[model samples]
Target: MQVLLASPRGFCAGVNMAIDSLELALKAFGAPIYVYHEIVHNRHVVEHFQERGVVFLEELEEAPTGSTLLFSAHGVSPEVRQKAKERDLRAIDATCPLVTKVHLEAIKYAKEGRTIVLIGHEGHDEVIGTMGEAPEAILLVESPEDVDALEIAHPEHMAYLTQTTLSVDDTSRIIARLRERFPLIAGPTKSDICYATQNRQEAVAKLSADADLTLVLGSQNSSNSQRLAELSKEHGVAAYLIDGPQDLKPEWFEGVETVLVTAGASAPETVVEAVLDYLKEHYDAKIEPRLVREENVSFPLPRELRQLASS
Candidate 1:
């Protein structure tokens, strides 16, 4: 069996910044640090932090008064920030810069009296945060069907934004549908999907074409990882999104000869290696590293952490 390992698979700049901010906070602020949400979407990452005395809270009120709070990489709405401020929780924002950019775009469009159409899945952390920027002015559309059913008061004065983790090809199609319906719909000059998401999807598209099976190392709740598996299935290949080697089933590899291995942005490379090791022990798989593109992106730590470091 042959294993095709993706090069730009795990720990993109945003996830790195979020995870690092948490670690730095733990070191500087002592244990029982409160994070507004999972530092990243991967279970392994969250579990690791939990073991290190980091507490993940879904609500701002859950954190004790004066506790240090770190926002997740998914970003938060201005309302969330306001609430955090009101609660007097010492806060560190770990939002991905790209996600922040989308929020800014939404604010800009709304300020111009344009209704905002967001292209993303409903209830996703990123989508929720972006929508909160202009709740009354923003409309959510997950597909072309949603666009067709949309009732806009001012189609002429509308702009579109997208979640950073969306499938590039799917988003393009949805954007086309929006444009067809509203000829004057405005949007960012470039797509809102993040570079890391785009690169991984492109690599998986290539991998799915050449491999009999595709294995994506990531948590089930991870939006980007689920997209990778979906893309492989779209290419007519059997794909599984697993958290780690423990989730791997031998039945999946029974007739599979060539397997493509990749991880989501939040997944750790060590987990990928564990999966590979399992494959090697069982099938004696030959590893072949596939480099679709070289990623050199990096994001700075949160402002609070920087200030803490300097102080």
Candidate 2:
């Protein structure tokens, strides 16, 4: 068996910054540090932090008064921030800057009296956060069909935004359908999908074309990982999004000569290596790195952490 590894896979700048912020917080403040959600969507990453005494909560009230809290990389709405403030909790925001950009765009468009059409899966953390920015003004749509079904109160005054982690190809198709339906719809000055998501999807699309099978290392809740798997199948290749080697089944390798391995932006490289090690032990897999592009993007730590360090 031959294994093709995708370059620029695993741990994007946003994820790195989020995780590093948590680590530093833990070191400085000690255990029982509360995070609003999984620091990232990867199960392994979350579990590792949980073992280290990081508490993951879905509700703000669950946190003790005056306790330190870290927001997930997915970002949160202004209401969440206000609620945290009401509770007097010390908070560190770990939202990806790109996601924050979309939120800001939402605020700008809504302030302009434009009904916002958000292109993303409904209820996704990032989508929810972006929508919450202008809930009264934002209408959520997941597909071209959804766009067709939309009946806006003000068609003449509308704009569109998207989840930061979405399939680049699918989002483009949706955008086209949206423009066709609402000929005057305005979009962001720049794309809402972040650079890491676009680059990873492109790399996987190319790899899937040549490889017989593609394995994406990420959790089911991970939006970008799901897109990578879907894109592979779209290219007429079989793909699986697995958390780690534990999820791998021997049946997947049957009659497969070339396998492409890639990881989502939030996934750790260690998980990818574990999968590779499993294949090596079971199938004597020969590994070859398939570099489609080079990624050097880096994001700074949360402002609170930076200030703490400087102080």
Candidate 3:
């Protein structure tokens, strides 16, 4: 068996920043640190932090009052921030700037009385946060059918934004449907889908063409990882989204000759290498990295962390 690895697969700038924020917070403030959610969507990353005394909470209420609290990379709604403030918890925001940009757009468009259409998965943390920016003004649309059923007060005065981690092809189709239904719909001058998501998906699409099976290393709750698996399936290839090599099944590769391996933006490359090492030992596989794109993006740690480090 041969393993084809996808290039540009694993930790994006946002994930990198989010993870660093937590580590720096731990270093500066000491342990028992509370993170509002998984800093990034990778299980190994979250577990690593858990082992280091970082507490992951699903709600603000879970955080002890007056404790240092950090928001995850997925961003949080205004309500969550308000609750944090009410509780007097020290807060550090680690939201990806790109996600914050979409939230700002939702706010601006809503203030202008434009009905905002959000293109994203309905329950995704990012979507929930973005929608909360202008819930009254925003409607979530997951597909063309949802767009068709959408009823807005004024179609002419409307705009759209998307979650940062959507599939490029799926988003384009939904955007096209929105444009067709409302010829004057306004949207981002550029795509809302982040560059990391686009590059990773493109890499998977390119690699899945000739591979016998595709394995995506990521958590089940990760939207981007799920999308990579879906992209592979779209190409008529067998694909599985696994958190790590432990989730791998020997039967999955029973008749497979070539396997394509990729990881979500939040996934660690070491996990992928571990999976590859397992495959090499078990299946006598040869590995080749399939480069589709090169990424040079890097995001700095939060201002507070930077100051503390410099101090």
What's the number of clashes in each of the models?
Answer: 0, 0, 0
Q: Is candidate 1 or candidate 3 better by lDDT?
A: 1
lDDT winner among the candidates?
2
Give the Å error, residue 37, model 3.
Answer: 1.7
Cα lDDT listed for each candidate: 0.92, 0.93, 0.92
Error of 2 at 119 (Å): 0.6
Identify the runs in model 2 with alpha carbons over 4 angstroms from their true place: none
What order do candidates take by lDDT, descending?
Answer: 2, 1, 3
Poorest lDDT segment (10 consecutive residues) of candidate 2: 302-311
Predicted candidate 2 versus true structure: per-residue lDDT over 12-55, tens digit per residue: 99999999999999988988999997899989999999999999
CA displacement after TM-score superposition, residue 34 of candidate 3 (Å): 0.7
